[model samples]
Target: MTMRYDPHIPDRELVQLADAELPAVRSSEARVHLENCVTCRARQDELERARERFFSARSEEFAAQVPAVDSSAALLRARMAGLASEREVPGFWSGRHRAALAGLAAILVLAAGVAWWMDGYRRYPLKPDANLTPGATLSVSREQLCSAPEADGLRVIPAALAGEVFHSYGIRGPKPRNYEVDYLITPALGGATDVRNLWPQPYSRGAWNARVKDALEDRLRTLVCRGAIDLYTAQREISTDWIAAYRKYFHTGTPLPEHARFFKDRPWE
Candidate 1:
């Protein structure tokens, strides 16, 4: 039997779902609803696209000007806790005061995120953790990856091995739809079926999410097959920083609409 969501999912809940922080049961229900409900899905898309644009603007335009936050993310979180404690007063529970606290807390959280980004924590969630997923590949010729009938961009992650991947990335018991246990170098490009080549890629964290990377992979494969680009260079570019590779190959500062919407199925899913 199918379940339908009444009204739309709340923006906060949608954000939580996108972040892969939603509870397991609810996440499944929300995904079902998202699949069946175009209105709700469009709303979520708006939120994700807006988030991507914000990150792009920050990275390209403002990153140079914004000095790194002095306080570490941990310190900022502590400060937010301190603010909650210190702001207590008679009648401080009023709506206006509560709103103020919420606003300030949000700022602190954003600051903490920015600090994390500055310190290189953004790489893993957006890119792979180099130490954990340095990428591995089979010794196949370009003709194999480019011309073989089996070179379809499908992925096959073993259940037990996938669990190890989540644990290594410190992501325990994640909802399947929320993150793709993706290969850093895809099989279509001769990627190895090894733990070191895999990472749990969130589907909706930022603009350069797993879907965008899939587009780059397809484009790279096409180029390799067409002799427009060499396989080694394509592999090197993708393994290094796929978002940059997307920009270079697609000749766009941000992802194209078609690329963002494309999804290649993983058999394990």
Candidate 2:
């Protein structure tokens, strides 16, 4: 049975009812009331259409305001003016001024890195030390020899098997100037016989002699091991004719005197 409903309720309340908040039976009753009441139904339709038109117009207006090129130019001018006012300074430079400075700093850093790399490459030239053969001659100046701390007071000459060795006895410096060591072999024994010990003094005595002996032993061992010479055969040859070899090779042609001797007949085990 259709029941008569109230007609005096506000259009606002009718709008809420039209939103489907009522129970099924109440919503059916409200629908019947809406059909009969033309005034309230017309008000609800007008509200819905007005809301749609207002939103559609606002969306179009917002779309028009979005920046094209001309709008961007206007925005840029406004931003510049805003920045100048915020800084309280007239004709203030903007972000565009810093671009050149940033570019210049990057260029300087790149140049410095390139220069550093070039300097390192120049200082350390790539060359092989092993390519220098034993017989390869070198002409060095007197200044160069004297200036070198390691070779100071010692002569620099091309002779076979002349080398240095570090030992516990240590080096006695201020060693006589221009006197150089030489290596000579005995023909009778097919190996190294003598090592020329040249100095600007008489023979080394007592403690100095012991020190010299130790130095010579150390030097011989170094030559055998590091220089890759035949250890046993060289020792045997040196023992046999070391004194004679020293006198003949070192003292024969030179005015400088020979000062030391090979201590044992066979020093190596």
lDDT of 1 by residue, 249-269 (tens): 775789888876778846235
Tens digit per residue, CA lDDT, model 2, 1-269:
99988565466655567555666876777678778878867877887567557755764576467553323434444445444444543345465655444445445544554565444322221110122211121233323422434321133432232222101112233243222232222111122222332111112322223223323434444444444445454454344333322222232222122224433222211
TM-scores for all predictions = 0.58, 0.20
lDDT of each: 0.77, 0.37
Given candidate 1, what's the lDDT at residue 258? 85
User: What lDDT, from 0 to 1, does candidate 2 have?
Assistant: 0.37
**All candidates: CA RMSD in angstroms?**
15.5, 42.6
Query: What stretches of model 1 exceed 4 Å from their correct place?
Result: 1-124, 150-154, 267-269
